[model samples]
Target: MKPASKSLWKKSVSGRVMVSILVSATLLGTTAACATKSGTDDAAVGVTDDVIRLGLLSDLTGPFKAPAEQQNLGIQLYWDQKNADGGACGRQVELVTRDHGYDPQRAIALAGELNDSVLAYQISVGSPTSMAIRAELEENEIMAIAMSWSPDLGESPSLVVPGTYFGAEMVDALDYLIEEGRVAAGDKVGHIYFQGDFGEPALEGLTYAGEQNDIAVEAVQIDPSITDLTAQVAELRKKGVSAIFLNAAPPQLASVAGLSEAQGLDVPIVASMGGYAPQLLDTNIAATLEERVLVVGSVTAYGADEPAAVAVRDLYAKSGSKVPPSQMVVLGYAISAVMDAAMEKACADSELSRDSLWKVFHGDFQIDTQGATVPLDYSTPGVSPSSQVIVLRPDKSVPGGLEVVEKDYAGPTVAKFLDR
Candidate 1:
């Protein structure tokens, strides 16, 4: 079961009948069906005669590395496990990857590389790159499973993201927190976010949720270039806020987490998906978080209840991830599942085109809101899941999500108002 709060994706190769051809990516993006192209090994565009190829462009060493590396590993692992066992449709799946350094320009070039190799593509980690390559994606009609929550990107036909916009989910999370008394009524809310379209949606989600819920919310923009967070934290504190939401990358996220702990503010330090510290799972740092500063997370947290997730941790240990296992690591496993399913669909339909692949990426699917109580089925068109999110706080039994919370609060579907 994959966790909600966005995801990265992948699949495997091998165990398939050899097509006797090794297609080159340069001629792979031709839209029309290649009933017969040429170059038995390097088929021209639209020419499908075996050998399924996949391309992944992720932030290998940038802000998104933590998650992207996991995604890449998961994809590699899936291919390794599958090819050894047999790839989708008995046809070997080939995966090619490039490091984007989380730069948009690099992402654009990488996108071309991806299009040249496979009919479908999965771009993970960071929205800057996603935004940079958005237009090109549409022009090329590449099938994608990116992990950003920007609503604007959703409008494009090529995108196939898990669930829907994080904006709505954030609203749901805020409402759940307030109604549960996690926050008091009329309390001031402050947000510290990175500037750009990447951070815009989360801020919008917060902005919308607070407005609709009657909470006073303020925005505090932080430049990635800035090294410290004292000024921002102090300013938000001055606003009389009882809680603060952080929308930033690793650098700023670490700064915020460290500063908040050092400041010793009583205010809750709520975090966006990006703000949660994936590297702090094994450190004493988790113990330092303000008691109420829980970050929002999907059900795949390091402490989730599922056995599969447990298996993922074991795999992490076996594979040797430098950073102790965390929710982000498990998230890589989830992305693999999604990609595997997409690959299967691509092979089966004989339509290795991106448009065809998107048609079945999630297998007529829906996620249970990242493993929520009630299954969110996105199998049908226009229908998707609305899984629950959990609060990531220190001293809590679980790091984040409802994996360790009382059963009732584990997810949005698991109501806390049963008596009512």
Candidate 2:
């Protein structure tokens, strides 16, 4: 296929077949009719007579390499099962993958390289990378499902993110702590965040939560290279914070968890989704995480009691892959399900072009992952599909190394923050 161009989209849509959403039985009936009507394989970039291709911009060898691999496995697993079931629109789905090593420039270069070869990007791994490529994606009319939860993602109509942003996640986490009697309105809360996209947005949410509840929030911003949390933890300890919120990676999480225990800063350590890694259970800080840490996010926890979560676990187990349980896998599968639905919608609409797929993303459609995540609605631009989040705690026994503490949680402050 040629690179995406205005002429290509124009030609592809020249012969179109309009249709509404249909059930499985009716959908099968209409699939052939639409193809027959269109009468040409020039339907869109990244699609051919017998195959549909989607791009995966992943991080295979970077700071997030472990989770990235697990996520890649989930993506492959979903497509493998999908192909076995006869694929979308009677065409096999293929992933055109590129690893950016979690670097923004590399991500941009890869996206430019794959622009015309895939219908859409099924995965864009990092917040900075997603933001860096946002303008190019809009110009090219390509849709992408960015895995990062940076609040800035909502500004782009072409990008589809799975759950609430980092800001809202922190807000909900605060609410969970307050409800659990770990924190109260009169107390001070400390937040240690990276100074960039990931941590800054979370600090916004924490600040908003504190303001709404009349609580004081102590902000401690750290650079990514700073691994030790001794000074930050000591500062918060002096402030006598009721609880601490973290928006850093696993190594930082370890420092905070371990140092807090040693220093006797007894408080619930709430974290954003990026904070905890499943491998932490094998570390010396495992008991500390289990006792005080609470990880919050919009995605469902691995080994969650939900049927969809259980089904994914079973699927992975049946695949016989040696990779241990990780929430990243569940996330990968869930996002793929979202993209798969959009592709089918575009195909059913009888115009499987980049333009049509872009429309499907911004159109009025609700995606149900059957419980793997909150049902998603991307109809409204600049808004998250759902505000609901799940609170999790470290548990070695669980397949994902974390168990759901609150399955469906949307705190009082979330709606206000999102609106603002």
The model with the greatest TM-score is 2
lDDT of 1 at 241: 78
Clashing pairs in 2: none
Model 2, span 1-420: residue lDDT tens? 012344423433343333233222211112222331234456388887778899999888889888888888878777787777777667888998899998989988998999878888989888888888988888788889988887677667667778887888888888877877788979999999998878988898889989998889999988878999899999899989999999999899999999999999989998888888989999998999999999988777888877657766877888999876688888887887777777777766656788777766656667667667765666555666778788889998788899988777998888988887
> Across residues 180-257, which tens digit of lDDT does each residue of candidate 1 receive?
676665777887777775466667667766766678778888787886888987787677777777767656666666
Q: Point out the worst 10-residue segment of candidate 1 by lDDT.
A: 21-30
TM-score of every candidate: 0.75, 0.91
| Model 1 TM-score on a 0 to 1 scale | 0.75
